[model samples]
Target: MSGIPGANRQAPKPDAEGAGSAALGPRPATLARYLTIYAALWKNSVTREMMFKGNFLLWIVVELLWFALQLSFIGVIYLHTNRIGTWTQWQVVLLIGASHFIQQIYQAFFLINCTNLSELVRNGKLDFLLLLPVNTRFVVSLRQVDLGAFLNAATAIAVMAYAARQLHLVLTAGHVLTFLALCLVGVWIHYSLMFLLATTSFWTIRAQGIVWGYYNLFQIARLPDEAFRGVFRAVFTFALPMLLVSNVPVRVLADKLDSSRLPLLLVGMGVACGLVSEWVWRLSLRHYTSASS
Candidate 1:
């Protein structure tokens, strides 16, 4: 017999102390690791989209046509009047460009991935995502990209540049930086709202209706902020804040914002929405019943 009982048997099980230490000691993925993973994901998405070259080109053409039509409509409106709610043709064009920039970037980076979350939950694919050693929110937000939408964003930037030139608006470095920051804040607001809506899938197996409703509501943001008044203004300005999404950035660029604190308020609102969305997502995860279960 061996000196120890079952000496040739399987290796000894970890002791309680050792197991507890191991359980508590593993480090989470670092920020750099997360960025690396996201880069890989984006590379794969671009590859997949490129594989369907015809479809990609078709989408690009369709988006360009739609944008052109929007510009034509704006031209018609300006034909009858010199200004719409104190916004000149060029200023309103700038606003439209800003709206398109925000919308296209949101769609390219976050919309598709976030919308798919409901499907992942419905089919229990989210379980695999949960098992991955990464930040669930970050992974969920950036697993895909729409190259065509990025092309549209570039077009919007060109339009804004043209409008700035036409208006003879001198854009300082500070003005440009502030506009870009506010544009990002607009994107964050859109993502936060969409994520919150998608998380409703935890309770309602198919929450696409809510997503569509959000699209309908957000369309109002495409118009100039001065176009709304009274209850409409109060509702979109304070309650939902769709107006603030593109309007604040446009105002900042146009040098039309009267109050210095308006930008701060916009930043605060975006941060508050993002934080609330995160909390709601965690709460929804707790309520989620995996398809396997």
Candidate 2:
């Protein structure tokens, strides 16, 4: 394993100075170290975002406009039909809000960082990431944050809340908590899939096209799962499992859990994808040849 070019390597010892002292402290427990690193990265990301006020505001405006357009489209569809599949106007809006929330959360935290893996591999920047003391995957996935996307996430939450109120869906504390948990599972599924795609750069040297294609496929999840049938439904539900991301959470919120097994199925799929992605990443690492070589 150690012989592999990009295999896990011990972090170099810090110099006697203060810089290394902070990172080299008697290695903290794994979870503690990971949390500490994530916190620091999040702080740095917020600080950096603040330094570029114009860009930050621009992205926020663009995201708002995009979400508004989605809502307008939904309104237009409702004008023609009372419901989409089994979902009513407000219910479908809830699903759309859930989708945006999960997508933005993933984008804010993991997408930017993971997408950079290809660039890192192509330009040899991955050398530094591989040498970090922490788990390489953790470092690569959580190293950056998008503050603007975080704001959009908040907007999505507000949309969900408003939609729920409009629908008169009585949401208890348990319902809210469960919905949030399932949303996190949805984000995990997305992260697992996208991370897997990004790792392909290790072999292809350029996998952006594949990444974009995956994103396009993910758009299907924004619609109600019941809108598809037969083979198309099976492909997304079992193979890609994108539909389950937003659909399951929205169903749970709407108290439409007649399919008692759906939650377990969604969770099982997420765990499966996560494990497979991790395996693929390790395999990619073993196959990696540094750019300088």
Candidate 3:
């Protein structure tokens, strides 16, 4: 339960006599206002997730195992050849850690509801979203927020920082800004991919295999894009390309991408992917002949 705007507590809706007029502010008049609903809805979601506190602890355990595996992956690769690719051990570690950080933003900030959205569409709960006062896209994408995954994100920064220090990397404003830009693009690309996957539910009732397989692609996110060469890189570089979004951010720090130089090209790719994803989402909406009245 959420508080009536003027009510003293967080419980939903109060009597007019106790909480003043029942009428709340008119529907959000601007995009910014409607976007705020994401935050409000997220707060409610946080409460819901917290109610199952055991699951939160289990998530933390899973996150620990996840981080350990990625780190150990880099370790094993280094032992085999001292460097499986051009990157030194530290560079590879930084890439792995940075990938985790980026992955967290996607999972925590955007992918939560979108990934599971197919269920709502299949079950007919989606019709209710269409009738809500908020923007349907916003409502659908942010129906919930998962904060448990954020622990992985938080731990990842520490890993990234340690790796950066080992490599003698120093941070600069230009690097930071370029990284932020790439991160935004990366988040969008990630969400867009998930959105496109969820949209399949509009036509099909089951897509669990499709969703799981797509997510498994993130395992490749920790590697430098250049490690993929020849036809493999060509295929991944554009078609189903996780490389452009993940490795691009790592390169921002490694300076494979010169911030002083072609910053526009890197971000342009992100924007392009995001736009295509949004277009696909809208197209899916057009096909949504609701399962329920």
Candidate 4:
């Protein structure tokens, strides 16, 4: 039995004789759990979207505007400096494009995952997920999907490919593989960072700064890490490193960096973020004074 939302009353559990109780057991595939959460959430989001068709188109237009704004920001940079932090025009394009690329992947493919943190915390609905017969992380992360954001990511990839061609860069097999890997790492890092931010909502009850801070931090991706010297470099490299999220992929693809520790950095950061954010999630559960019975 679990509590119903809003009513703040525990709902009666299905009896042992019920099929839901008897058929459901521990799922062996942890990844499948994550995907299932996403599926369920996406189904809900689609239903939500249908309630406002005009707003859905507005959301699409808004996302496109955001993409255009980012590109325009890069354009403004080129006007002042021919080369930003030693990166050529093509490199800057790729760098910005890569950041957008990493961003799009998540927005496009994993929309519901982003909203789970807030929904779980605010609605006191997380307990239902906790009762589910699966790994909680997978359950929580995949509770929703956002197709609009996913489509945005797809467009970003297409743009990245076009940008790469204009740069006249001939990517080697190793380079291509490495670039793809870095993009993955970048997405993980960004996700981990957001995860960290979202968990903060458990304490703050509001997540305003995180999204804005991430957007501002993303701007740094347009400039090469080479431009940030000394202490500033250390800040980005270690404390909240956008280097891994956006810089590494572009650098590797641009042939500026032959040996990047970005992948290792990503994995290490991912592990660290996952472990800590998860720890926070668990701690929050202990602190969760749910009004729901």
lDDT of 2 by residue, 1-293 (tens): 21111123322321124225544555444345556777899899989999999999998999899888888899999999998878899988898899999999889878888778888999998888776655577677778899888889999999999999998998999988988888988888898899999999999977877787777865788899889999999989998898899999999999878975888888899888887987888788888888977
TM-score of 4: 0.79
Per-model C-alpha RMSD: 10.3, 5.4, 7.5, 6.6
TM-score of 1: 0.89
Residue pairs with clashing backbones, model 4: 37-142, 38-142, 41-144, 42-145, 107-149, 108-149, 108-150, 112-144
Q: TM-score of predicted model 3?
A: 0.85
**How close to the true structure is residue 8 of candidate 3, measured as C-alpha lDDT?**
24
Q: Give the Å error, residue 176, model 4.
A: 2.8
Ranking by TM-score: 2, 1, 3, 4
Winner by lDDT: 2
What digit string (tens of lDDT, one per residue) describes model 3 on residues 29-65?
Answer: 3434544765698789889988999988898789879
2 versus 3: better TM-score goes to: 2
Q: What is each predicted model's overall lDDT from 0 to 1? A: 0.80, 0.82, 0.70, 0.64
TM-scores of the candidates in the order shown: 0.89, 0.89, 0.85, 0.79
Per-residue alpha-carbon lDDT of candidate 4 for residues 173-266, written as tens digits (9 for 90 to 100):
9987878777876666666566667767667666645644666777675567878788877777777777666777777777776554765775
274: Cα error in model 4, Å = 2.5
